[model samples]
Structures are given as structure tokens and as C-alpha cells.
Target: MTLPAPARFGIMTAPSQVDYADLLRVWREADTVPGIEHAWLFDHLLPIYGDPRGVTYEGWTLLAALAAHTRRLRLGVMVTSNRFRPPAVLAKIAATVDVVSGGRLDFGIGAGSRPDVPMARREYEAHGLPYHDGAHAVSALAEACAVIRRLWTEPEPFDFTGEHIRLAGAFGNPKPVQRPHPPVLVGGRASATLRVAAEHADVWNYPGDDVADAVRRGALLDRHCADLGRDPASITRSLVLPVSYDDPAPVRETIRRATAAGFRHLVLMLPAPYPEGVARWLADEIIGERPV
Candidate 1:
């Protein structure tokens, strides 16, 4: 198969209550970055990194604001966990963001696991929501994907019956500008996750540092696609890389290795204190060169 060039590159901003200006600045700089195609933010009510009390911005609101300010880069949440919101509501939000961005939206979803992030347990009890273990969360994610897709495509007031979600005559209005719907990016390394990606998602983003591992995962996704009687080429495989470097060499090497390993997209995770540095690093490297 001929490998296509990456269509999106991004970093997730850990959500907080007060980082809107900084997040906007990051989006502006990334929009101008040479090789970057998108800017992503994490959807959470609290910080996933740094001090638990540090400033953070809401993800969807930040994406909406970034859409208005930056004319170029695509925008999305890294992966909206299935536990946090109802599938119908999530679908509507994704459509809204896509409209706001004029169709530059990538919907990345997954069974989110942030055990050390403090906010998980808090919300579980406070809201009396079901606490999902990894397996259960993955199940919920699969069901949610079907629900969201149905809500996007099925004509006016469709009914959905699923393991986790059941609905009758739910609204899926305005329809996403991206044909069919906005691209869905699913993240996980497990078999179930790959199954979900093969069956539903447009992209598969895996978070890891191993190139061979990414290749192996990509192959697994391909095999899963074959089993499902779907074309493996239809799903894009990508990586979420950490950019903790002041020097550009490491980041460049990382993207190069990942691309060579068959990852079409590199989701670069920008450093928190200086997010614009991510744009500068991308400009200095990896822009016009074809992968070797």
C-alpha cells in the first residue's frame, strides 16, 4: 500500500479553568506551523498534568474559540472519553465544532482512562454515574461510536438500541460538513479498540514511543479491517508523541521514525509552559521533506 502523508498533527492541552489566552496563543502559532495540520485539546474539568491546581481551559470551548481565531489548522479533542457525556450530546458538539471550524474538525474518541488525574473519581461519585473499568469503558466507547454515527447519518429522529445506550427519535441535525460526518479518530492499543476503529473510526491514534510497536499495531488494525471485510487503507494510523525537548533534533527524529514506521499522522504533545515552541520546532524541521 502506498502510504499517504499525514493530514493532521496536534498536541493536547490539559484542561483547566483559566488558560484560554495561552491556549489561543498556542492555536494561533500552530496554525502557521509548517508541518502541523491541526491543534488538539483535552476535554476535562481539571488538569491532567502539572500542579493539580494550575490553570486550564475547557476543550470544546477552546476549540470553538480557536476555530474563530485560526483560519488554517484543524481542531479537536484528543479523544473524548465515553464516560463523560451522552453519545447524542457528544455527536452534536462534534458537529457544532466542525461547523465552527468550517469543516476542519477531527473527532477523536475513546474509553478514557486517567486514573492518576484526580478528577475521574471525583466526578464518578458526585454525579452518581456508573464507574467503568477498562473493559466496560471500551464497551461503552464502541456503543457510543455507533450511537454518534447513527445520530449523524440516520434521517430525522432515528431510533438506536445498543448495549449501553438506547434511544428513540433522537435528533441528529445540520449534519457534519465533512461528507458522511467529520473524521472519527479512535485511540487505543487493545484488540477491542482496533475493532472499534475498523468498524467505525476514520483514524487510529496510539500513544506510545516505540516505532516497531506502532507498526505492529497498524498491522493489527489492518488485519482487523480485513476480518470485517473493510479496506484497511480507509483508516489512518497515527501516533501521539511527547515534545518535551528544547532542541529540535529529538522531536524531528521522533516524527521521522514514526512516519517510517507507517504512521500517517503524528500527534505532537506540546510542552505546557511554552506551547508555541511546538510550532517553531515543526517549522524548523519536517515541513517540506518527503519521508525517507
Candidate 2:
């Protein structure tokens, strides 16, 4: 059976404040927007790449709250770091979130970077101390995926015996509404990251300053999928494009270029204190056509 193109279009909710009610309102509005297939938020404790003082919210708690407020709109973290949470716990949490959202949850995982260093360095620091070895991150990620899968599909309690996480008779119930599992989306530019996605992800999210880079990275993902004997068609490609909107011409050009580059789902990352004005602008000018 031919799969329809993955749901296209989303909005990223990354704010400088930790207000659940305010964010929920924005997500509700987004759910009604025509052509928008999903909504996403970032996962981080402190600002990973910006001023340390920037306001950051807990990704899972906020997502759980979002699930309660919106009836539609697929929701998930843009990409969560592997080192932040333990694998077994993350698995159960994701399953619970999926259940809460009535199966609208998608999981995006990655090896994230710190403010001052490239993530490839593998030395992730928080509060001024080293946290994990670089090479070990991938192992943790794989183990996490394994535990989540077992939690969702395996009958009765199951055990996840891995180097980083160990589970004995862990039980998870009320399986996600999505059969088997919710879509797992992975983000990164590394070959190993791409390989991991090829093996496990239901969607591949590409981030870039421009559409061209996103397409380039997307093509790389396709190649990786081909190598792994997975159908490229099975993996949905999404892109996040930053917009300033000061110049209509440049922004339009960027959108045109991005669509041409095969970004089926494109989300714009807006700044904090997200108001109706930005949503209106994106709906009227960018998303095009009125909301549902």
C-alpha cells in the first residue's frame, strides 16, 4: 500500500517563559490551522545554545499538559538529548505521553551539543561538569529505543539488559493508540545519527538556516535509509526554517526554496512570548489559506 506523504507543517513552541496555560492556547490555535499536521516543543533544562538565563521548560510535563488541552495536532519534542534522562524511564515516560495524547506523540531523539562546544566532542557538560562520554551516547540511545519498544509491544513485564540501563520486570500498560508505536523522529547531521534513524525512526527532521542545507541533509538521510534496506518512502522528511519576516521578499524566497527542496513538513521557530500576531502572520502569509 502506498503511504500518503507524512503530515506536513508544524509549529515549534520554544519560549523564554514556563507558562503551560499560555503555551496550551497557542497549540490550540495551531491545531485549527489548515495544512498544519503537528506541533512540537524543544527539550532542554537550561538554554542549550543561548543565554543561560533564558527561560526553559521541562519538555515532558509541558507535552503532557498539551495533550490535555488539544484534541488534534500531533505533538512531540523536536529532539531530546540522549544523556538527559535514563533509558528505561524515558521509555515509560514516552509511552505514557503517547497514551495521554491519544497516540499523537512522536519521539525525536539526538546527541545534542552544549552552548560552547560541538556535540560531536561527546563531552556533554551541565552546571560546569562532565556528564557522559561521547561515544557512549549512541549506545544509550539504542538502549533507550530498545526499552521503549519492549515497554510498548512486549507482553507482560519485560527486562532490558543493556550497558547503560537495566530493567527487570518493568511493566507499561494502556499502550499508545498508535499500533506498535508512535512515530519516532530523529535529528542530526552525523552519519551515525542518520544510521540510527534509518534503523529506527519513523521520521527524519532536518534543521538548517536555509532550505538548501535541509534538503542536502535530507538526501543524506535517504542514502542512509537505502543502505539499511529500508524504504526511503517510509521515512518522512521535515524541516525547521527560521524566519525573521523583516523582508517579505527574502522570506518568500526561502519558503519557495524549501518547498522545492522536498520539505514536506516545514515549521517555523518563533521567539518567546508567542502571541496571536505571529500565528496570524504565519497562517495568513506562510501557511496560506485560513485555518480549519
Candidate 3:
């Protein structure tokens, strides 16, 4: 199996407190960075930290808008929750965005994990979305992935019966601009999640700042791929590291360690209240120095 090219960099920004105009400005500026390959938004109904009641923009809606506004940078959520939308509907949304962006969409998804805050839980309950945990959640995520792939690739209407999702006469129209659909990036390190990534993902993304943890998860993913008779190299290895604009040294070191750990794609999560010119500075100082 041939490994694809390496050293692609992305920035994952949370849509917290930023208005439409400001968000568009950030995206436009990030797009000008020479080595920045993609820009992503976090998928969260509420802020991950601080005041949970703070304003947070919807990821898919922002992505569609970004697709129209930017030309160079690939766009997607860092990982969208499977519970937020039906699998078929998610597929259609992704396909439409791919078309709008001229085939520049990376469909990142993950099993819905329970948030630590009560407000978040209330938000889920308010929307009547079940927030399952353990094996049930993993199975749902895996089934969602299967359903999405079928919707993108299968032409004839077909019934999909899975442990969690059941679809009748499902047909996805206006197939994605990207052949076989845009890259399905599965995020998580759980055994079941890795198994699903091995079977369905074009990319496997692990979060956190620890390089050792990333290495361990990558090895586990490789084992799962091997067990399933899949080429480990076929799935792009990616890591998402939260960055401190004030301290660039550690971020640089994290990039070095992630590269050594065999991650070809590195996504930096810029902290809230993103400083002016920081994205460009990182692109020029860190990502641009690496070979693509």
C-alpha cells in the first residue's frame, strides 16, 4: 500500500463568541497562509469551556458559508457528532458542501460523547437527541459511517438495517463532487472507533497535545487495520494539538514529535480570542518550514 504525501497542516477554530463577519475574516486570513491546507470548526452546541451559555455557531452552517467564501483552504468540522443529524442528511449536506467548494470537503465525524456540563446535557435532551455511551454509542457511530458511505457510493435505492440506524429506500442524489465522496475522517481512539476507522475512514484523527499518546493510538489503529486486511497507509494519520499563541516553542516541539510519530497531517487548535497575525505567524514560522 502506498502512503500519500505528507506534512499537511490545518487550523481548527471554535465558533465561540465570534460573529459572522469576524469568522469570515479569520477564515479569509487563514486561507492566505502558504502552508495551511485546511481550516476547521469545532462541532459543539455549547462552549467547551468557560461559560456554557456563551454563543456558539452551528458547524455545518458555518462550513457551508465558508465553502462559498474561501477558495483555497479545505473546510470541515474537526469532527461532527453523529447524533446531531441523520446519517443520510449528513451525507447530503457534505455532498452539497463538496460541490459548493469544488470538491474541497473533508467529512470528519465521531461518536457523540457525553459532555461534562449539565447545560450541554440539557441541550441534547431539549433537542430530543439520545446521548448514548459505551458500546451503544460506538456501534451507532460505526453504523452512521456505513450509512453515509452507502448513500454516497450506491446508486440504486436500498434498505440499510444496522444495529442503530435503519433506512428504507434510501437514495442520495447529486453525488458528491469528489469521487467516492469526500474523505471520511473518523476521530477517536477507542478500540471500536479505530475498527470503524480501519473499515471506513480516509483519515483517522486523534486529539490532545501528547505525542506519546498519539503514537500509541496510531499503533493501535495500525493493528486494527492489519487485522482487517486493510492497508494502514491508506488511512491518513492526523493529530489535533491545541496551540498557545503566546508560547510557540512547545507547539513547534509538538509538531516535531507528531511528525516523528508518523502523523502526516497536523491540525492546530487556536485558543479563544485568537491573536491577530498569530495564524500567519505559525504558518510562516512552523508549518512552512516543513516539507509537504
Best lDDT goes to which candidate?
Answer: 3
lDDT tens digits by residue: candidate 2, 143-198: 77767777777779876677888889887776777888888888776667777778
Better of 1 and 3 by lDDT: 3
Residue 70 lDDT in candidate 2 = 82
Better of 1 and 3 by TM-score: 3
Q: Let me know the TM-score candidate 3 reaches against the reference structure.
A: 0.94
lDDT of 1: 0.76
Candidates arranged by lDDT, highest first: 3, 1, 2
Native-to-model Cα distance after best TM-score fit, residue 11 in candidate 2, in Å = 0.4
Residue 254 accuracy (lDDT) in model 2: 65
lDDT measured at residue 131 in model 3 versus the true structure, 0 to 100: 78
